[model samples]
Target: MKSFGQIIKANSVGKVVDFDAGVDRLLPFDFTATNTELTAAMLDDTELFSDWINKQLANNNARYGVGGYNEHRTIYSRSAHFDTSEEPRRLHLGIDIWGPAGTPVYNFYDATVHSFANNDNFGDYGATIILKYEIAGYVFHALYGHLSLASLSGLAENKFIPAASQIGALGPKEENGGWPPHLHFQIIEDMHGLKGDYPGVCRFSEGDRYLANCPDPNVILQFDF
Candidate 1:
């Protein structure tokens, strides 16, 4: 297999970042970010450019991809918190880059539309797209959940995803299940051939299995932030 070091970048320093700062940037959320030394501008979010990640989750939503190590673990998983609704909450499988709607999203590598569907639910990913690809002989897949309706209009399975292709735009809160606009990206080694649906969120009991198979999307994204 090829080393993901070649496919992804750390934090948000990628082609998509140029389109909008909100799209990607290495936040001081990780230990390395703090080690790099945070600037006054990085601490201020009034401009809406700084990352809102913290030990305490904002608006009862799960905390993901933030902490002292920049490792995976949710606010609910932390012992200091008092919320019981989200048990086994140890962060998330994907990095959530909060931003505005209509933010352009693209394919990280060449892939084919494995499956897709409009998951309409209160806390569900509004619209999702699953793409399959191969890297250095490793067959794998990526899921882009919580996309906008416009992103899925007229889309079909088996569609082509050339490397660096623009697949769709991010959805707003209203259209994307009332959360801040962000892309829920997850990597899959084995799709099990399921189509139009897969579990982006699962019970804590299955966390280990998912984490092992999922690995770090940043492995390909190269976004260490």
Candidate 2:
């Protein structure tokens, strides 16, 4: 049997997103301590973070700021969600699309709502949605994090969601775990019986294993990042 990543790549044609028409250039964002662009002062303030992101986009002449797959970041320190006695989770596992709040997000392929939840902790996922997809007898999952609270309304388990269907909107600071609006997109090879939530980051030491299970989201988003 082929791995989930290989199957996704085989059917990558007609996936989702219009980078040239709807989306602008996809900027590579760095949140590591070595990156001077994102200051420590901006860590707790969502407004400041959004302003910094906007400036990065403006300076680059891009409409959206993206990247952060397997990236070692220092920005996770604000929340205990990424911290542990052993190691801090700084390696990002998802592809984040930084854009304005309330930007509509679409399902890339035919799927059904598996679960939804509001991880209301500070610097958490806020309103999140997970969808399940089956292809060639192999089942996989997709996660959309940092969504508007309103996006979770009326969602139920196993609800059918068509390809390219507008599913939810990007959330703002007050509702999206106190961060700038962005879509945390991830493809999961296995849910591990999880729902509505999954680790979008992992420790640097576990990069190989975590990355193998969570493949590049560009397989679905099709963004040339």
Candidate 3:
């Protein structure tokens, strides 16, 4: 059997977020501890963090700020939701597309709605959608998080969504777990019997296992920029 990443690379996928990588510039953002620009105060204040994101895009002449896959992000310190007695989950497992709220997110392949929910926890994926895809005898899933609550209003499980169809819109800070507007996109080889949500971050020690289950989304994103 072909590997999950290989299967994704073999198939044709659509843009999860509408943008022409060839025409529009995408900024690679760094939320790791090395980025001195992300001060503690700035990370705690959503408005300040958002302003900083916009500034980065504006200065770089980019349409959207992207990145965070397998990143050891310090920004999670602002929220206790990621904390535990043993260790905090600081390693990001998804690619974030930082842009304005209400930005449309599309399904990259033909799929059925696996599950949907409003997580509502601080630093959580406020409105989440998980889609199931079966390609070349391999079954896997994709997760879309930080979505507007309205996106879940009429959605139902097992709803057939055609490729390139709009799935939902990015939510504002007030709705998207109180962070800057962005779409959290992740590709999962297995759902682990979980629905509507999965670990988008994990402890640094668990990075290997989590990363294996969650492949690099760029294989499907195909962002040339």
**Ranking of predictions according to TM-score:** 3, 2, 1
TM-score on alpha carbons, each prediction: 0.66, 0.92, 0.97
Q: Tens digit of lDDT per residue, candidate 3, span 35-112? A: 998999998899999999989889999988889999999999999999965789999999999999999999988999
Q: Rank the candidates by lDDT, best first.
A: 3, 2, 1
* Span of 10 residues, lowest total lDDT, candidate 2: 12-21
C-alpha lDDT score of every prediction, in listed order? 0.57, 0.84, 0.90
Question: For model 3, where is the 10-residue window of minimal lDDT?
Answer: 216-225
Candidate that would win on lDDT: 3
Q: Largest TM-score belongs to which candidate?
A: 3
User: Which pairs of residues clash in candidate 3, taking residues 3 or more apart in a chain or in different chains?
Assistant: none
What would the per-residue lDDT of candidate 2 be over residues 15-79, giving only the tens digit for each residue? 43335746467787878778886777788777888898988888898878888888888999878
Query: Of the candidates numbered 1 and 2, which has the greater TM-score value?
Result: 2
RMSD values, in order shown: 8.4, 1.9, 1.0
Q: What is candidate 1's lDDT per residue for 1-225, written digit by digit as tens?
A: 344445443222233222333443344344222233434454332223223433223433332232221243333222222133545434456655544567678886777888888777645667888888766566778888768988887677888867676778778756665444667777777777677666554446667876666767756554444
Off by over 4 Å in 2: 12-18, 21-23
**How displaced is residue 154 in candidate 3, in Å?**
1.0
Better of 1 and 3 by lDDT: 3
